[model samples]
Target: MSTTTQNRLESRYAGITLEGYPHALSAWFIVALRFVMGGMILFAGLGKLAFVSGEPFDASGFLVHGVDPASPVSGLYAAMASNVALMEIINVVVPITQVLIGVALITGAFVRLAALGGAMQMAMFYLGGWEGQWLAAFDSTLIYALVFLALGAFAAGRIAGLDRYIEQIDVGGEPLVERFPTLRYLLG
Candidate 1:
């Protein structure tokens, strides 16, 4: 049986109480979510790497015409598509970065950094595929970005991931995070 603990959260900003609430979460659920998300992203990268298509991947066409014309960032997408060097860089970087992020999340290594990258990618996708309607704009990309943020905030990797052991590595008789406090921002 899972045990429940009482936890209170409070936050204030600019002389105002933003939030004061009690919340509970299941540790196992978070771990499962991480795995599922990682697998989905991994397969996506693999697909772009020719696992799904027999031909090479190209983002120029998507950047040129796939984006909704009414989207706020359509001009940006068009500009990106117009640049040959940038397109070449993006075509390779997108898939490779996705694979790296997926591996990091699955192995529970540098999860915070991976989550940041994932969130940023999802944000770009969300903006690139803008639906023009406010309600329609809240799509899977937005949800994925939020989920990545939540994973980083909760340090889900430590629950049953390699990060737990990584965090305990001795560095000059002190834990790695203790020795290098800045690492806490990258690994969790």
Candidate 2:
């Protein structure tokens, strides 16, 4: 090698670094992906649980058909209209989910599980988007969901977080992790 190349390589530890400065581009993407989606979920959960208003939603009226007061689930938004208490509880839980998942992403703990949950939540939200309902308001969330699934597929957690710890447990080569091929790429 040339003197300049040799000197540069030596200075850079032969380009070896655990900071994921190189060769782990996808891993870093996953981390960012988790943060963005987690934030949205957290916000949504908190918002729904916190808000309380008796007036029927203009959007809800558009999503569901006419209602018969006698029928609990019918009439525009009758389902939601009847479940004020449940909605409040959901609001609280949703925020908690957002905060916890956000922590997991930021700290790199159980990242796969957190990503999976994030993906599922995104799918549910995306699917629930009907007839220009709140779905349209948050249609962009679908992209985040797809990103989480990709992160899970690549085992982003192992590269960045507690996956290393999980892998250390002796279960005959960690059968649970072994079942997940992405575990192979996880940091050990």
Q: Model 1, 81-138: lDDT tens per residue?
A: 9999999899889888889889988988888998999999999888889969998988
Among all candidates shown, the one with the greatest lDDT: 1
Full-model lDDT for every candidate: 0.85, 0.55
lDDT, candidate 2, 59-153, per-residue tens: 23422443333333344345563566755555455556766666666556676677777777666545444334443545655777877776666
Clashing pairs in 2: 49-91, 67-75
The best candidate by TM-score is 1
Off by more than 4 A, model 1: 4-25
The reply for model 2, stretches above 4 Å from the true place, is 1-24, 35-78, 132-138, 170-188
Position 108, candidate 2: lDDT? 62
**TM-score of candidate 2 relative to the true fold:** 0.53
